[model samples]
Target chain A: MVSIAEHTPAPGRAGGGRLAWAFVERQTNLWKRYWAWELVWLMYGVVNTLAITFIAKQVGNEGAASSINVSKLILFLLIGTLVWAYLSAVLDDISLVVTWERWEGTIEHTLMAPVPRALHLIGMSVFGVLHAVVRTLLIFAIAVPFFSIDFGGANWLTAAVVLAAGSFSIAGLAILAGVLPLLYPERGAQMSFMVQALVLLVSGVYYQVSVLPGWLQVFSYVSPATYILDGIRGGIIDGKSVADTWRTLAALGVFGTVLIPLGIVTFMVAEQWAKKTGKLKRQG
Target chain B: MLDELPLRAAGVAKTFGGGFDYGRLLPWRRDGHAPEPPRRVVDDVSFEIRRREIFGVIGANGSGKSTLIRIISTLLLPDAGEVRIFGLDVVRDTMRVRALINRVSADPSFFRNMNALENLLFFGKVYGLSGRDVREQSPRVLARLGLDWEQALEPMSHLSRGQQQKVAVARALLTSPVLMLLDEPTTGLDPRSKRDVQSFVREVREEHDATILLTTHDMEEAELLCDRIAFLSGGRIVAEGTPVELRRTIAAGRPLDEITMETVFMELTGRSVEEDEEPREVLAHG
Candidate 1:
């Protein structure tokens, strides 16, 4: 048959435009089969919104309000949960994709492609974020009336940018976790669990960073997760004037820029090391 | 069709790192990612593939066949080597290497949920194939592969293994690359699919003016396809020449009909290797 993957005409292939379009297309295809992940995240978003609303109600006793008070407790909880949910895979599943590919005996195939190795991993992360966004949108559509939220015009597009940048930064951490297997295959599974635990305990997913001890708080601030949460919280829930969130948005942007490049570079170095050491076949 | 050389690697040597050095022919001694060991995968390996030349890399597993192909395709760097495609260094000029080469490994991954056409469209954009051109051209490619046009819309998971392998080959062929790296492209195929893929390679070389670098463990495949054969053992070339010349070198005493590759292999290495035997373990190497 005629070749399916012929190099299309160029001028388009130069610079970020082509690569970004490639990634965006790949992510869309990836999300076609992501209904299960979508379902789980939707339920999780609901569960989190409900759980936080109850917790805040208890903090108020006979009607005491949150430190960050809001008349609609459910809306506040839902907004935070929906936005931060993008961090789940980064907080945990980065290594799992490799482990998953290794177990399936497919990573070798991925490596064989002429495309750079980092693109596939980053593509997976971008796809995961896209999947998360769909579920978050679904939850918003369903829960809007139940929570009686006035999500009207309080800077929704800015909220999306801040959340996306934050999540991508965390995905960089996830990508780093993913490359550990290529470098240290046997340690891969263990490291996956350890990273997930760290994200859970230290990233302040369930509680504020201040809740952790001082040293742990310092570590959390260093986490890409912290910037993600800070950006999302600052943009969506806080929804203060843009001037109020300038610092948080900037921090998220800086982390976003650094995270992807750092992760890809680490992946490249580890891949070079693995091939040299015959680790590809062993791990596969 | 290709009057000029498309890919060239001169004095190419790939070394294993860490613990084991597999190069027995070009032995050196050193450490820390340096080139002081003899377990060179492509020991001083030099060759030039002209455009449209179906150059094949044939050797036993661990004989550095795949390693050599990978290096040419810019997947791995050589320890003491230089690979240039139209004067572009595979190392210093990686983006160029990628643009010039389209590699189809033994296996390829596709989205399980998407049909063959969907996967093509996805990768089409990756190669910068976009818009109506991608949508219209996908089915034409699929049809050429003998896939039913309707199958383009079916989920990939429902397809047979042989069919999926075809998709992998199709993805590589889709790009019409200047240099094609086929690493055991037919390793898992049935005899028929194997022939189909082999024939496709031959066709592409003829029609597209592409240069092909293929690696395989099957001697029959090598004898049937490769223009020049290199007997690689222990990560170095023990012998390399045209099949007739190689057979003649070993046929000095034996009849031509009896001078199969097995005899030639045994004559050089003093060990008879068979495709059936699980081959040597990859041996943890540095």
Candidate 2:
């Protein structure tokens, strides 16, 4: 029999595009196998949204209904819950970049491969964004019917633009949080949830940032999710055009532009530290 | 270019467990206490490998064989020294160096849910192999290692340890890397699987334009496969030569055929390679 090594080609250099697409493809294959988990999360999001949005509908009084602006109240809760759901999903996916590999016992093999660090992450971020969008859209599809939502005046195109821009910053924050697991294997995974929780509270997932204490308002300004929630609400509820929410959109763009690179660099540094400290192989 | 000598290590050193005072965490700790001394894992070690040569590093557990392999594979950096692969510095040209090498660790990792073919294809793509090439090459490689093509479709979690190891070897070979780092490639294999892997290693050295740096504590395996062997004890290369040359180190004018590798190891390290008779306590140093 002919030897397999005879047909083997010389080792080739990894281009960022090909490697990134490979990562995307790998993630897609994984999702195909475990799509039930995604459906479960989608159902959970729908139930969570309905439970929160119905708070305004529960008060059975004309005076309370008029004072509450029940329609706007539901919209607020809808946007708040949906945006929070999307942002958290993206964060969770990207942050698990290392954790998933660790869980699968493939961290060393994957990390030691010849692919560029940026492409590896960009590919994962691409999958995260795509996965988050699909689940969020499904939740939205199942959700709008529960309420008499009026999309006739809603600027959905602007909302999508805001979501796209805002996703980059969330991607950056998730990459930063992902380094926590690489750095502190024992407690890092849980600590990442704390970071997400802080963002949830400060970004006004359920209430306006104005309602937060004076000190926390500073964090709200720093969190790109705040602008995402604001811009998305403006587009979907007020029917504001892209120009009307350009400032928030632009802020998100700037956040994505800066944080992505910053997050990558921070993660790389932490990775080096982990390897040096023999923490790379740590599994829980 | 950069193909004459496949591997070279110059005064490589790595240390662990120093820097901060962990003892101070105790409730009865006092001030002005110094931290524990750093333990050197790979202590000023250096060696070189020629192209297409199978060089083996033999040592007991915790002798820093894996650490040395990691340093050479560019997975871990040397604290104080240089490692060059094919005339390229492992640190300076890490990406290029990585492209030229592939490693098969003792316990290989893979996507458990994915079949062998899927894992191999994924790894192949990461190493810049085309999908078609991966598909064509994976089966043949697995067959050479005593694994059937049909069995390669099963999820890795369902496969036996030996079969998974064969898949790991297949994945490493799929890329046709210039240098192959095998960290105890046949450490826990059955006799047949061990012989299968050993035969594949010989075949790779003969057919592929590759240099093999293997680490193992198995004396017979090293003798049969490696062109030269280095006995690493306590993170240092205490003996280095071909099997015959190593045997002659303590031959004492006796016939060379009477000297076994075990005798050489016993005379050099004053301990049997077998684990049953050894003490259970592990020292801090590598």
Give the top-scoring candidate (TM-score).
2
Worst 10 residues of 1 chain A by lDDT: A2-11
lDDT of 1 by residue, B1-286 (tens): 1124577778887666435445433434333335333344566777777656666666666677777776766556677879887677887776656666777777656767767877776666565555555678667666666677777777888887777777877777676577788888888888888887888788777777677887777778888888777776666667777778889987877777778877887788655544322223333452
Which residue runs of candidate 2 sit more than 4 Å off their true CA positions? A1-14, A59-63, A282-284, B1-3, B21-37, B275-286
lDDT for each residue of candidate 2 in B108-215, tens digit (9 for 90 to 100)? 788888888888878999888878888988878888888988889888889988898889988988888778999998878888888888998999888876789999
Lowest lDDT 10-residue stretch of candidate 2 chain B: B275-284
lDDT of each: 0.66, 0.84
lDDT of 1 by residue, A89-123 (tens): 44444556667656545565445444555666666
DockQ scores for all the models shown?
0.27, 0.44
What is the DockQ (computed on Cα atoms) for candidate 1?
0.27
CA error at residue B88 for candidate 2, angstroms: 1.1
